[model samples]
Target chain A: MSKPVIAIDMGGTKIKIGIVQGNTVLSSDSIDADSGSGLRKRLPFIQKAVEDLLDREGISLAEITGLGMASPGIIDSIQKKILSIDKKFGDAPGIHLEEWCLQTFNLPFSIENDARSALWGEWKYGKAKNFDSAVIMTLGTGIGSAAIMDRQLLRGKHFTAGILGGHSVINYKGIHCNCGNKGCVETEASTWNLTSIARSDKNFAESPLAHAPAIDYELIFNLAQEGDAAALHIREQSVQVWSACAINLIHAYDPEILVLTGGIMASSSQIVPYIRKHIETHAWTPWGKISIEEGEFPDTAALLGIAHLVGN
Target chain B: MSKPVIAIDMGGTKIKIGIVQGNTVLSSDSIDADSGSGLRKRLPFIQKAVEDLLDREGISLAEITGLGMASPGIIDSIQKKILSIDKKFGDAPGIHLEEWCLQTFNLPFSIENDARSALWGEWKYGKAKNFDSAVIMTLGTGIGSAAIMDRQLLRGKHFTAGILGGHSVINYKGIHCNCGNKGCVETEASTWNLTSIARSDKNFAESPLAHAPAIDYELIFNLAQEGDAAALHIREQSVQVWSACAINLIHAYDPEILVLTGGIMASSSQIVPYIRKHIETHAWTPWGKISIEEGEFPDTAALLGIAHLVGN
Candidate 1:
């Protein structure tokens, strides 16, 4: 039997690590990363975290075949380096992720952009299986998407092709994105964009949601379901924007299925059907139907994806 | 030395046939084609048109390495069949393109969606050769697009990926497309959609454009240049929509260079600068600047693209 692989997903706020064999999770652990801490300070914490997991599980590091690391930034998988960290983590671009793994465990490591890793996971072992082409979207703090075409990841020359589909424009005259593009789908509908979307509403001043200091899609979705008119309007508009973005992905990647993940899609009961119906009505797919499905892997999709990457 | 290839471009209004070798046209001919005449009837005309070129150029069929065909509609290059004719040639999907070529000249042939083929031509031999990731948008009868990723053509599982980028929605409540989608880029700004767009304008009744029987973009652009208020408004709005679409492609495809091709780009002196300025201000690429340029192949880009496909 093949040894299990370690999969690690490094997010802006947390780290999720798992021991995975094929599609099943053998063992897993999570920790609050507090990425605001500088890279140097975080290094020892990461080492301790992995060591603690092995101790708790009573597993030897020698039993691990490899490690797959998914991080939130532009990643050069070839070099195992984060190319641009942006605002997610300080000095991430300078870190040698492979070198760290080599020194610690003497294991081969592969790293990738979080969205791409999630897509790799989903396509290999989750809902996107059996499809030659698929696009996985994570709709959270920022919208992230990745395309798998002909059963291979469609990373462009700069490793930034289909992954940027979420930033596709849905409203030309809408708000500006942190990426500097005006009216991007992420700018109009993502969790990061939702606070302003809620604040811009006329009923925001009178709604119960106004009392909440912080707002996210979950709050908006729950409030809308509870009959908050302001929340309902934002929710509907957000649905439309997300649907448009979905259609754009459909058009851009021509995938057989779209697997939607991210923290926000925990409300997939609302999002999947809405996007599916909108696409059914407005999307142009004369050949056949395009399926919009919820992602089976949630927070751990990327981590699990690392296992698939390493195993494959 | 390999002999020159025969390239044919079938359009809604005209069919262009030429002998092309390394971007140089040794001989070329054009014939008016009414696509509404139906595909079965047009085949004889198209074949005869090409044969006429063979006669005029005195080039033997054996000397021609292969024939490359570009047509407006969805194409299954693998099957060598037109998938969806898009109302231009309703019977095209039923026609056997490869079989037709085999029976006619015992020659192997390749067919591609016109927009995609144009990008291929340009990427392989024309202005877009420098960039590995690029998008080509053709703004003619209908807005069409093709993308190149890591120097390979991006045809997703459904063979619809990069080809449908123009169908992306710019306004949630914009015009309806013939493709059963509402608020499509094609619906808002294309030769086929121009009539409805102009008719919906509030000032259409009062404008001098109403007096003109034909209201194509040429007249709109000329009138706008002459400071016609309504024309200028429409022009500005079209530019905004096109710019927004370009930004969407830039974000979606992550191309360092975006090549705008089509009949409209013939007036590139105006369109190139407008799109470049808008993209510079609106597009988000933190790494460096994105270069926006016009297609040097003009209308023949798609026809030449067929040869590239066959060579591949």
Candidate 2:
């Protein structure tokens, strides 16, 4: 039998680490991260967390084949390097991630962008096992996505192809995204930009949500369910944006199945069916129908995906 | 090459067939096509044209390893089948294209959608050869596009991926596309839809182009250069729509190069630079810049691309 593997999921607020023998998660640990401080500092903090887990579990470093890390940045997987860092992780690009792994555990390792890694996880052990071509979209602070085409991750020539699905324009004249493009689906709707769109509405001054210090999809869905007019309006609008984006994905990628996952999908009971219905009506697929499913593994998909990566 | 291949590009107006040895077109013939007559009638005409080319060039059918044909539709490349038909083709899905080719020539045959085949031609021989990842947008009667990712054609799971670039939503509330989607890039800016969009603008009533029998980008570009107010207004709008769509491709596919080729790109002096400027300013690629260029072979790209398929 092959040895177990370690998988790490690096996130903005929390870090999820786990051990997997095959498709099943053996044990896992979670910790709050000072991600705002930048990944350079977070690396040592993560090292301490991994070492503690290994010692507590009484597992030797040698028994662990290697580590699979899912991170938020443009990744040069072949070179095992991070290419760019967004605002969340300030100094990630310069971090010597591979060297750090080699020095710490003396093992080979692989890393991929978080969404792409999550796709790997889902394809390997979760919802998409039987599929070869699939598009995975994570509707969170910003929309994140990755595509698997013909059994391979479509990194493109610039390592950006499958990773930039969120930046697709759903409305050409709607709003300008931080990515500098106009009317991106993420700009129109995402947990990060949801409040701004709500404030722009004419009814915001008298709305109940105006009283909240910060806004997110959770509060929006909750308030909408409670029959708040402004919240309901925003919720419907958000759903349209996501639905339109999903339709675009269906047309652009031509996948047999589309996987929807993310923190925003916590209210998926309201989101998934709505998106599925919209794509059914709006998408122009002539051959057959495409199945849209709520992602089964939330945080654990990439973690399991990493374990599979290490095995390979 | 292992063996010379026969490549055919079938369009609504003309069919071009030739013997292609590597990137060069050896013996070629262009025949007018009466697409209104339907596929059953068009096939014999095309077959005679191919036969004439073979006889005139003194190329033996036995020496041809395979045949490749490019048409406008959703295609199953693996099965060498055409899966759908647009209005111009009358009805094509019922035809057994591969079977006919195999029986007629006693050789294996392959077929693909025209836009994708054009992209393959460009990647194999034209301007896109320098870049492994690229997007080719053909703005003719309607907009068509093909994407090459990591040096391979991205057929997606359902043969829909790159072929749907024209249907990208540029303006959410702009116009209704024939495909059931609203405000698609093609509906707003392609040659087929440009006349309607221009007619909707109030200024078009007074423009020189309004007097033309058939309005197209060629007439609009000409009138815009001569300082017609309505033509200039529509020209600017078309440029913006194309630019927005280009930026969308830059974000969605993250290709290193975007090759613009089509009947409309005859005015590429205006279109290519405008798209390049917009993408350079609007896209959020920190890796570097995306290069936009007019394709070296506009109409013949698909024909040459068919040769690449046969060679493969």
The prediction achieving the highest TM-score against the true structure is 1
What would you estimate as the lDDT of candidate 1?
0.81
lDDT tens digits by residue: candidate 2, A1-312: 558888888876788888777877777887775777877777777777778788888898888889988887678888888787556776878778888899987878889888998888888777887787888998987788888877877786667777777788777667888777788888998976888988997778888788999988899899899988888888898888888777777777788888999899999999998988877877889877888987779868888777887788
Error at B29, model 2, angstroms? 4.7
* Candidate 1 wrong stretches, greater than 4 Å: A36-40, A102-107, B104-106
Off by over 4 Å in 2: A55-62, A104-107, B1-6, B18-21, B26-33, B51-67, B102-109
Score each candidate by Cα lDDT.
0.81, 0.82
Clash pairs for candidate 2:
A172-B170
User: What is the per-residue lDDT of model 1 for residues B1-312, given as tens digits with 9 covering 90 to 100?
Assistant: 346887888877788888877666678888776878777787777688778888998888888888888888778888888888778889888878788888987888888888888998888778889687888888888888888887788777757778886789887767678887777787778788787778777888878788889888888888888888778888888888888889878877888788898876656676888899988887756567887888878878887787667655
Best prediction by DockQ: 1
Spell out the clash pairs found in candidate 1.
none
Give the per-residue lDDT digits (tens) of candidate 2, residues B95-148.
888888877778788899999999999999999996878898888877888888
lDDT of 1 by residue, A1-312 (tens): 567888888876677878877777777777776777646567677777777777877888988889888887667777778776646676778677788889988989998889999988888778998998898888887888888888888777666677776678788877777776777878888886688888899999999878998998888989999999999999898888888888888888788898999988878888888998998998878778887888878866798787877876
Worst 10-residue stretch by lDDT in candidate 2 chain B?
B84-93
